[model samples]
Target: MDYRQRRRIKVWGKAEYVEGDSALIERLRIPGYPAKVERAILFHVEALSENCSQHIPIRYSATEVEAMMAPLVARIEELEQKFVGE
Candidate 1:
């Protein structure tokens, strides 16, 4: 089970090779941290599977959340202004 008690699948794989530094590796490297990815282990999947996402909650992007709250925020501001004026 996952953190949210959602069922998940396990996988079996083998380490294929150690990946060397490249453009993709450099892009993955985080700044200001002394630790760097000297090499990465590539995996060869023997078998893989996943369970249904029926238990997972829906997620929203920043723009979507802002758009959803805009009307409520405008109404709140309008009320605040009316009370201040009185």
Candidate 2:
């Protein structure tokens, strides 16, 4: 249709987690900025239910990465609401 309408996306993750002997030992990541933005957490754990941020990464700690991904994430969400009917 239009250029703007054609250029929208969704935030998807080829994400993963790394578990050790400890309770909080996993991660969630997405292609962020020009690199990968890593999020360490307990994503699917039930007993201690709900997601807990381990060491708690600042959402926009890396300036370059945050700057790059900020617009991308926003566009993706916008596209989701527009196209995916989310």
Candidate 3:
């Protein structure tokens, strides 16, 4: 999923805003797989979640395990941006 989001993504004139990031509607191309999987992810950071939901269940997705710490990431970035302007 992360690979699909980072490497290549396609949105058919539609997009979803998630976790301060744009979730581009994309389909994963897996050879030999008869199904085209649709997935999304956080671009700049990750998604943190203690309570599971439909979109994000389990602990984390591919790319990294600390994805469940998205809140922390956003907070850290927010503080950094506020303290240091770049």
Candidate 4:
């Protein structure tokens, strides 16, 4: 069976737009960049339903993903070393 099919989850909620706090906005602002987010949206969940996982995508842990990319990272490093030597 597909991975996503193993788990099904649904969430129902009400969305509310709240004014952003000045301190939070300032903290989130990047230096030298204009502020973009002026407000925040909050979701008040009313219900959660778990039906099926058929639509969910498979997810890997950090370690698992790192292992998968180890060969590529090693190849890049080897190429960098060769480039530096030439």
**Measured by C-alpha RMSD in angstroms, how accurate is candidate 1?**
9.3
Model 3 CA deviation exceeding 4 Å by range: 1-64
Number of backbone collisions per candidate: 0, 0, 2, 8
lDDT of 3 at 62: 58
Worst 10 residues of 3 by lDDT: 1-10
Which candidate has the top score in lDDT?
4
Q: List, residue by residue over 1-86, the lDDT tens digit for candidate 1.
A: 56345667878999855567576577767887788677666678899778787966666678988999999999999999999999
Q: Would you list the C-alpha lDDT of every candidate in the order shown?
A: 0.77, 0.48, 0.49, 0.78
The local lDDT score (0 to 100) that residue 17 gets in candidate 1 is 50
**Candidate closest to the true structure, highest TM-score:** 1
TM for candidate 2 is 0.25
The 10 consecutive residues of candidate 4 with the worst lDDT sum are 1-10
Q: List the candidates' TM-scores in order.
A: 0.41, 0.25, 0.24, 0.39
Sorted by TM-score (best first), the order is 1, 4, 2, 3
Off by over 4 Å in 4: 1-54
lDDT of 2 at 81: 88
Candidate 1 or 2, higher lDDT? 1
TM-score of 1: 0.41
lDDT of 2 by residue, 1-86 (tens): 12222332233334345545233322333335465343353345334222334433444347768888989999999988898773
Could you tell me the TM-score of candidate 4? 0.39
